[model samples]
Target: MASGDAGVLRQVQALFGVGTVVGMTDAELLGRFLTRHGDAAEVAFEAIVRRHGPMVLRVCRDVLGDPHAAEDACQATFLVLARKAGGIGGRERLGNWLYGVAYRTALKARAGAARRRRHEQKAAEMVPEAQAKERNRHDFAPVLHEEIGRLPERFRAPVVLCHLEGLSYAAAAGHLRVTEGTVRGRLARARVLLRDRLGRRGVAPAAGLGALASSRNALAVPAPLIEGTVRAAMQIVTGRVAPAGAVSAAVATLTQEVLRAMTMMRLKGITTGLLFIGGLVSGAGWLTHHALADRPEGQQEGQKAVPAVEVPDRDEGDRRVILGTWTTEIVIPRAVDGEPQPPLRLEETWVITGDRIVTAQDEEALKVGAVHESVYRYTLDPDVTPKAIDLTEPGWGTFPGIYELDGDQLRISYGVGERPTEFTHDDQRGPFLKTLKRVSPDPRPVTPLFATAPGGSWAIHPDDPGGATDKLTSTIGGVVLLTEDSPDGSLQVTLAHPVDPGAGPRPEYRAVAFDEDRRRYLLEPTLGGTGGSARGGVRVSLQRFRMDPEVLPEEEIAYLGVEIVTPGALLMEADRAFERAEAAGVEVLPPPRVGEPFEFALTTMDGEVVRSEDLRGKVVLIDCWASWCSPCMAKMPGLKALHERHDGGFEIVGVCFDKDAEKAKEAIESLGMTWPQVLVPDDEEVRRLWSEGSMIDGLPRLLVLDRRGVLRVDCAPEEVEEQVVRLLGEPGQPKP
Candidate 1:
């Protein structure tokens, strides 16, 4: 051992007494190490090292000939054990588990070393004859370890305990909680299996493989190595040292690779079983018959069928005239059971290609979000009366409609779940009409600028109220900006207040267009309340424009301002004041601290009022979501599953930021969101909660509250269930 390792060994021995946990089992030692803190935990972990360190080192050394690399792999094996102690199954057979981990870690280290060597040397270089022979002599060690690790648990446990650890059959049986005869039989069968596997790889094994076991048992593990491993593992688990800092980078990388491989193995097994079950369900004869019955008329069995409404000869002139990019803002009239409901303002875009017309609304855009891109396709029939069109979505069936194109303007009228006859907006229940303006003669490619735009809190400065020639020093409220690339080559910019949500007027801008020559970004503001609805007919304009500096400094600040339109509207012109705000850099508010009281009172869809105080006895999960946020909708199933698992002990309150209450209600019912929901923009209390907490920065934001109504965790959608489970296990009394 090295001098540094010797010194560490002496220090660890003096600090922790190995005799304190002399008689503990592997499971007992792991339990103590996980549950205890400080000296007690170190002592427990040290004992585990002393017991299994020799076997693990032997396995690593056999796989990797280099002594230093073997030691690194051994330490990484123990590190993985420390990190995954709680989730490890079959704890009693921990030696077997460690054997597998050690073998895999050694393999990873060997591959990495080989890669480094190849990179450092020239391609023409080759190993000498003597060196190649020596390498070939030891090639069976890795193969031997691989076969042993692949054995089923019933056979592997005895082999690992007896042959690898140098335990007698009786001792191995005792450790496995089985009879000695069973251990002897399993070991005999394991050796026969190993010999056959080795023979297939062109390496004949010695009879019984007893010589191999004796050699491994004779190789003594250095005390300093064990001591150093234990110290590093303790520091890592206690958060005193990160895994990478505690060990060499190669070892850390090897450890992570092994862990990822193990997780993938488990997932693969689960996926295979699910696939088998799915195959069984899909193979049912009656299901196939039912599927065939739904095929289009005049379609023969196993023959492809074209769409029933497909035109034989396409109208080249009509298709060419409509092939470009177009955009529109329209109000969708909505009602439920003949009751007049609030209308939904929708911003839509269409990109018509030679064969298909791609249409996307604000809601459909939200469904794809940033992680995915989807387009709704439509087949146009310019030959029919009023120019028929049929829109088709993947999950939704086709809807028949009519369209008319005149110069740079286009109009379309369509209905959901039915076909429309005429182009009119008078019948609220029959057809929805929209008028769109052409943005480009040819389909324009989505600019990379939107994909690379800076996001976060940006300081805002309106035009100087004093009407001074120079820029103003004072500022109004700041805007928290988030930008995403839409599939139709447009930028979706979401604007909100970074601090004091209710202090200023919140404007919603759904899509943005950039002008290259003038170095200006045009934002078309959707006229609506902050809750996502417009009461009157929709209007489109170049409402907001930003002048970006030609060369941005290191801080990445850009000047933004809105052109003066309606005086009392959300946006106004301020060219000079906007330049001042850009020089000030970005301003981000401090996030709300944990354990802060998150108080709110809002009415649910059932007309029953719910308050934070009333939910004091149960763990509460406040889900801030909107119907137009696709990522939020994707998270609903997991939230519903969490609610079902802890129904009585936990509660979820959804703060819906949808403009239309009826639409929110429809989404809630469709997604089986049985939890109480409060619609925003209509409720002042919910709006105050959003503004005060500064939680409008993103969608699908989850705030977990303890039984005492104190915020315990503020997390994303994926982390909600884990935090909820942990908080549910804690005890807290209701606040008086």
Candidate 2:
């Protein structure tokens, strides 16, 4: 804890009946806080952050890719756990539990982020200036470490824990709730793929395979990579790099390179020359021949082009294959006639350049990110005989084969692949050394259905909302599906359309889990047919409308979400039970829904007393806030100002939704808040209230009550103020 807080804590502990708090450990102070405040844990937790927040934040940020999200998640996770001083199982295990909480919270944040990305898409790259400034921060080692973050969450999770997180194969397995074998297989496959991809980029494995054996030790992404990356990241105002149209970009770069290599000498003199033209044709053939040699599944999903590693690089894939080190080996195909492949330049370079944009909300700052870049180059011998070279690995799914040979065409094939264990070895005719071509047999067929609030069709007018079945419906089937309909799904809007022109004209797709044992799908616009609302996964991004638009004749969009799974409402009771909790000095999230007629309730840590409900008809505003919530904190001054401005028409009952209630309460007081504050309680009743009632998972919410004690407004502080002013009702309305 900060030295400053130690002094203040001593003062609070010295208060009547309470022994000196100055010398207490964080755990002890926390115990006293729960024992004293009950629901006021929010206030105390906030105070705790003011004391030792930096350490917590540093750990969270380093573990999670996003600092802002990490901070918010840390605060929210703590809020639910605040009152459980004794329940933390014990102080010694605190760090472990905290790590578990951090991990889970980060995962949820990542899931939620799939939605936010729409509003904040960025190209993450640095400008020259930022790159220069960060040079000192990056670490570059002879043996660089890499992790497969882009793989499915399942694969990514295990690999990250074992590699980046530095957990033993067994220990990592334990944490992931998987068996050690599963971990080994996953790591083996992941490492193998990483090597291939690195080779494609013309980068040699950073270390020999033998290194993995020696390191029976898990992994730590070379510190240099981390420092260098972040250092490069920090220097720029913005680092977003937008991608060029995929089909166009991938084909043009890959095909053009082959053409140049083949025709460089012939075309050196003239663009209009006949010799030059002939060379171009030959080069195009070579390009097609080489690209087709490493065909991934027919179609590309999120396929991208990467730069080859540096030209003067000394690393070679052949050298490290035996050592078990993960390395990139760009293996060109030799002709069946036993001839060496033609000359090729395997490139491995980090492409650094991106778009720039000021922060949308606060223009003074910048927010930038990008569509990460990776490149793979290939070559073939002169015989035109096809030789096999493995480009993809087992388990790793495939993206569409994007090909563009010497500008004749940019072809994007359908996405296809079986699980790694399910392999299909086939021999195809020679692809001319000229250009790549993909022939998708036919778009897969599917059947799609529509869902509404009433579980039927399209709403035509979604603004007219009431429930899920309040819309119209239809279905589609057996049509060519096309590209994904949405980039980042916030509203599940894409689910309303065919996954692509290839999946099927109809709308039937898969979902992660079942809701009422129903088929998940979408509706499409076929001629004049009405479309349907949809449902599907965000990450996997599959779409199959249950009610295919072609088959349904009509359809509507549907949004299915949860309100509260539990029967008894928590907010309804938070205020009715507040009085006693408040008197004991516990802060609580305000519930404006059930106003002055009732009070919120809470139990102390030791259950010595029930506090929240007994406070009084206090027009209590249980402020559910966090130290890391900018929006929540941003609205604080207005609340304080309103409290002071009105001179106490209502009592400001501050309740922190944080882990360390004592700390939160201290922060509350430090802010000059004269109101009584409470925090999370160790009592089971209070825990049930938060976990079951109100059904909240976020912060900075305000609950207000009317003088007559009716639930009024439950919103942000600013929103609450608006409601409060309106509730005052022009100062002339009759009161109950």
Candidate 3:
């Protein structure tokens, strides 16, 4: 008992005279206690615990599989009740609410335990024989409880009420507030699930479940447990002292877990609601910040900014300064083959007209068979850190990006399919960064500023994004050329490195051009080239040009990205490309139709080649996923259950799109996924299958195929089991 008030404690003791609580309804006792103030509240709280603690502890014990842990979880449950006692509303059955809370609390503890012992889980997988030896020592009750706890929430509740607590069907129904028939039906279904799960673990269910449900050998709740829990819960609830001991720590952990779960659920709800609202108010800039709060830069609010990116420039609200040509001076790192390499310069010109941004490369760009450019109508949200920039290219797609412009220095980064939250070069296929020095006076030379020009180099600025100064130069010709010098002078390289025609087409490189009519320096069309490998990693750049700026040394940074082609010319190029694709008979498939089979073959994580055709005789669930996808991970348990239930008739093919093979393999092993997992090494192919073939825009995509290899459903993750079961029960074999 708490040592506070003697009078209130004595009164509470009199109210609960020796076993007096036995006949009082839980709500009545709880109401009596809640009505009291101060010290009396603590006494009444203890009375509530004494009445309900055993049952809550029992449920926790069943769920958590350890008595000590159960007591701790039990304390945590009452602590929740104590905190929310005023809201008990006097209508709910205290037992039922506590039961649910206890179950969830215990479940949370189990998840924590699982996370802490994840390494042990890996060991269990690697040494299964040792696991078998360990499980052999435990009786069936523990195993039975483990299986029961793993049951879906709907089924598990009835099983706990009707079987463990020995509630009659009507009583269980009353507690669960369901029809008696519903209670009975759920218990029957629960039994079947439990039996199946236990059978897989090599435990004979008939004997174990019978013993588990009966009161023959139930563990007694410890005598001091109720009072200890009440005292601990009261101390926690009142906040008079800090929680102490293993039990106190457990209470803290469980409370934190429950609160964290509630917080996340609420956050998701808020995010979803905000997203819906964002749809209605498309121009609401705050929505973008909130929506991206879960992403990278938004996640790192108030932290030190990454070295690769600068803080957003408050001046970017006026897009006029961003209108001109910006060129990149790059320092290519030494090759993996240990060959010394010189800096490389690339340039991009963005000509802003109203809301539209026309993108062009320098005139010295390496061009191959065709000239290409793009026009994007853009929007900028300047309020957020690493301000959000969205660009929509007509007939292509929207490119989301972030930008930070510091005076003449401009850094803009963009991703292909998704907006980049950070300026990073880690994901080559994902996002790319371009830093430009704004050039003025149309730096494209009508007359070379070099006067009497040789290929002599100009010095790169010390503050350049490329991080090298002595290496950059541009040589003037009828066509301007940018070059970098090796430190040893072993090689002097120009931006026009030769590319083999046999290889795939190269992305455009920066070049310079003179505008005769404007008589100002102008940004050039990119020089297209044949194949060299795409620079898979970060490249720093410096540019040598035909003209030195009229200003002194620091003014070299003033070169701007200028418009290279007219909108009419860009439209012509897009039309030509479209015509070429049309001529090739390109037929882009939409997301695949349900009940239509498509052929695919890929290498499994185990290095075995597997094809859809090879798995014709079984029901196949093709799970297209990536490790980073939460929805995909969330579906694993259901898929695993389905795989287990229909082991002989069904097969699950996990098409993992993870770029990191180790993480993908570890997920498979940790999830204990026995299904054959296909690892798609090529990210582009994985994305194509997801976006074009599967037609599913998100991860955790599931495709069901009948026995004859015909796809039965192109379903969401939640629909996987239902579709799989329906397909398995279908009458005829599908055509291969």
Candidate 4:
């Protein structure tokens, strides 16, 4: 080794404490890197870099033909690996995965370099004759890389382990969990495939191909490149690097590009597969129809259809029956070990389409406005005594269950770790049961229940339980209730206080259930408790009032002590001033649109006022987030990075929808959110801003306003940085 390489190796060994991670597998190292924090994670990640850096560097150098560019591409590949460590499949063959990543990153870097060279006037003159000739000699390197990448994984993995990484057949076999003979056979087959592919690309000499592969095996990656890559990976993982140099910025850019590309490719594959399956299903239906029509009447009546189509085997029949929208109310027994507790009942909607199931619960939907869906791919086995079902979610493993189908009504009993033999439920142990009723024969997407409910203003009167009335008394007043549709499809119900009109009615309740058939709406008052049960544990239910005007005059209706009120009827009585004040105070704003100005002035946690007018000259990102939003909290780091990246050119104004300001503040502090935040519940202007500006479909919504104060993009948190960058590139309006 060179003296510089030796010195750098010593430095890395000392800094990373590499001895502790010795003999660890790639998966073990990756697990430690992801699950552990601080020094422990750094050590594991550094060990990974030390183990695989040379091969990655070799791939980068062969593609880019520039040492500096190669180093950047190598670092970016590791960064991608770091970001995707948890989602990566086939951990034992990590080297093969890294080889593919390295090849792709290098190719991207090479294309970028070519673009830059085209823009540079002295680009051709910059390279010396010797270096030019050397680059030409390795012209076939890219073709070899492409062909190797194109090889089927099983064939490619052994070649990557044995030829590129220089592992023995036995070691490769052990890593792959296959026999040595199998590894040898795969490698031999891989070599023939590569040779044939390279020849088609006009590289005919077998000797030259062998020399290129051997050269890749012999190339030594500099220790400093390994150290830089390890340090960059560690910094990027912790979100500590703010692109201090061009290379650092390039690494971040390249990593995001590759990750985005990979995501798009995966989505494309899924879409194509789904389309193919749909075509197959359509074709099968057509063929089945023709086959049935072509048969004679007697044959059709007496002959049994083939098992594949009309007489679909047990599993397929079950699948056909289960495909559609189903509704269920799951009640978890509250008694734990004979101790009495409130039984929790959840209204869940499951939409089963093709082989996938999407479940949405009403409790979460009412709280967040957007229904959080849990998706799983399911398979049914009807041959069992009690029909069996297994649900599989990516990264979550499989959940086994047993099902019973009785026409429109279906019952499923599932367990976390084991398959239940019978449909039974136990409070403390064993299977949990859910009885579902098919709502629609055709599969339909589950939407928030409140989105489909009626909204307007009504006057409510308390029904006297004692059934006593005093006609002489005249001081009893009625309550005005206003129901509005929130941007996210939740019903926001506000009750105006009987005595206090200036204080403004707060959003204290949400419509939980709306029975269209019964024409009844169940309003659950949120009193800082689960299920929003009212005080003294009494749940309130409202029914539409149906009374004749002859018996009770419309004017005298407000005076009646009846509990029900007509939907969408405004009270016209002596308390007109109070009614008008309440309506004006809690008026719902229209949904915000692109190119429209979003105006708001609200106080921050530190008692400072922030207004849209004050932020006119800069690009603004309004993050509609809450403390309870897990997805919002997950995005804080990226938001912080964007804040740091733009310096003073961009600004983020947080519109926190959290009911408790302290919790929101605590989350901001813990997550290092240094932007100006406006608490929605604390300030009226901020509340209006949230209702109008946000798409309101979900928490963690992001709204971007350009320098001209025009609303540019209203998107999810993941798309914030891209939108902000796009806006920042535009010219700002002149200061008034």
Best by lDDT: 4
State the number of backbone clashes in model 4: 1
Give the TM-score (vs. native) of candidate 1.
0.37
If candidate 1 were superposed on the true structure by all CA atoms, what would the RMSD be? Answer: 27.1
Residue 403 Cα positional deviation in candidate 3, in Å, after optimal superposition:
29
lDDT of each: 0.58, 0.35, 0.52, 0.59
lDDT of 3 by residue, 443-480 (tens): 22111111110111121111111101112222111112
Model 2 accuracy (lDDT, Cα): 0.35
- The local lDDT score (0 to 100) that residue 199 gets in candidate 2 is 58
User: What global local distance difference test value does model 4 have?
Assistant: 0.59
Candidate 4 or 2, higher lDDT: 4
Order of the predicted models by TM-score, top scorer first: 4, 1, 3, 2
Highest TM-score, which number? 4
For all predictions, the C-alpha RMSD in Å is 27.1, 30.3, 30.0, 31.6
* Alpha carbon deviation, residue 124, candidate 1 (Å): 10
Candidate 2 — which residues are off by over 4 angstroms?
A: 1-598, 603-618, 682-689, 730-736
Clashes of each: 0, 185, 39, 1
Minimal lDDT window, size 10, model 3: 287-296
Report the Cα lDDT for residue 186, model 1: 62
